[model samples]
Target: MTDISPILEFLPCPTPEAWIEEARKPENLAVILVDHANNELKAAQSAMAIMSRYRTGKFGQNRGTSHSNEEKVGLQLKTDDQLSLLNKMSRLAREELRHYEQVLAIMARRDIPYVHLGAGRYAGQLSTAIRTFEPFRLVDTLIMGAFIEARSCERFAALSPWLDDELKKFYLSLLKSESRHFQDYLTLAEAINGASVADRVAIFAGIEQDAIESRDHHFCFHSGVPA
Candidate 1:
């Protein structure tokens, strides 16, 4: 198993035992599997959304537009940065979709048909709280991505011991990659912000802790303590 101490340390609160127990119930199995698959898809979508922010042409001047030497240099630098971010998000998105495919395969073997589920409050709360300004917006989004990935990894680790052999192995495998994805997001956020994110991290940590510890009737991969 991957050493996920870093992921655990990054998270403000551990997933509640009550949630795990409720998740383990046979009655919830189908919902769990289906929701989990949905989460993977959502993860992929989030990565793409980040990539959307870095679209290449957006970094350059409009067609037939003139630029001073300094502006030209700035455009080149921004384009390079955009390309780098675009590459990272592309890989992250692809990996998430692969995980989605794996989950769907497992669900199929178990005869659990995919079903629609609503978003839980956890993501909406964090997203709505993000600062709606340049740089800060992207920074908060990346930070949010890191926390979500870290929590997912932690949850997988927490649930592994109780799962069947196939799921146990699959969840364990995800921790290594997903935890790395967590780190990737943090590194990118700090790089893009060009400053220490300690303050923002602390604030978001509190929000995440509240989201995790609050009583939530919603049952999903990222839900808080089961109500």
Candidate 2:
């Protein structure tokens, strides 16, 4: 496996040590694994949502336009950048879905029944900060995606060594794709915004950090300090 040290540097916020310590407990393993599977599915759905909303600009246009004609016209009107974003999000969505399946297979082997848990407050807290404007809203969304992916990668790295052999191998195998996903989101955000997203990225970084460090009543894959 490739060294993850360099890639870890790119993350705006690191997973807190307290959270990782909690995650590494044997009693928490089953819940952590189940939540992780759910997270993968959610990530795939988020990517698909972004692609659908921005791909052909159909979602952005006037409500009077017929759906069929809007799709046709939107395709014709799509800019090269929009096409690129669509392609990247498509690939990302597929990868996340595949990861979701892999996690489920692992769960099956371990006899851990899949359970749907309420989502942690981490993402919802970040969503509150998203700008309501058209392209800025999109930019904030992409930046949020970047933060989520980066934090996942960080948590994976932090938790891997403490896991059992099978889990260690699986988590290590995921680092590369998670790393790429963060970069893809960041790159697309900057490209779509036509300017450096450094300031905006920093802003989201602080928000994400707050979410990570805050006291959370529930424990899930992306949760903050365990209550």
Please name the candidate that would achieve the greatest TM-score relative to the true structure: 1
Best-fitting candidate, measured by lDDT?
A: 1
TM-score of each: 0.89, 0.88
Q: Which pairs clash in model 1?
A: none
Error of 2 at 50 (Å): 1.2
RMSD of 1: 4.7
Tens-place lDDT digits, model 1, residues 69-148: 32433433255556667888899999999999999999989988888888899888778758654455677898999998
Q: Write the per-residue lDDT of candidate 2 for residues 20-99, one digit (tens) a residue.
A: 88898888898999999988989999999988887675345343534542344343323777888889899999999999
**Candidate 2 residue-wise lDDT at 170:** 92
List per-prediction Cα lDDT, in the order shown: 0.83, 0.82
